[model samples]
Target: MPEATADRTVRIRLVDRTGRQVTDAEVTWDRLIRMRAEEHLPGHTARLAAVSGAGSATRP
Candidate 1:
């Protein structure tokens, strides 16, 4: 990134299945990206499952 764009904050939090505030853990970009991608798979599947084709839009 450019020097001017150095100011950035990636706030992240972890939690269990129950509503509990889990904290104080370390993570990396690769791990975070993979986790996020896996999370979106189910969401995307449900959103586009009823579409007619692969190029269909799930949202208006």
Candidate 2:
């Protein structure tokens, strides 16, 4: 039987005060993107989302 490969995806939500979605800083964005799209890190995807002072998490 052929080997099977599995992929993992991570999603995060960031929140700010007053219940409003906010954008991440450039540095943070780069880090998050790298974690998801690294050459050595295959079969995995990472996504980041910012919410109103509340963070969300996703598991794969």
Give RMSD to native, each candidate. 7.5, 14.7
Q: What is the lDDT of residue 13 in candidate 1?
A: 81
Off by more than 4 A, model 2: 1-27, 39-41, 44-60
Q: What is the TM-score of each candidate against the true structure?
A: 0.34, 0.23
Candidate number with greatest lDDT: 1
The C-alpha stretches of model 1 lying farther than 4 A from their native spots are 1-11, 16-19, 40-60
Q: What lDDT tens digits, residue by residue, belong to model 2 across residues 6-54?
A: 2333345545557676643333444556655773245322222232222
lDDT by residue for model 1 (1-60), tens: 443333333456866559686754555555556567787566668667656466566544
lDDT of each candidate versus the true structure: 0.59, 0.43
At residue 45, what lDDT does model 1 achieve? 85
How far does residue 4 in candidate 1 sit from its true spot (Å)? 18
Task: For model 2, state the Cα shift of residue 23 in Å.
Answer: 18
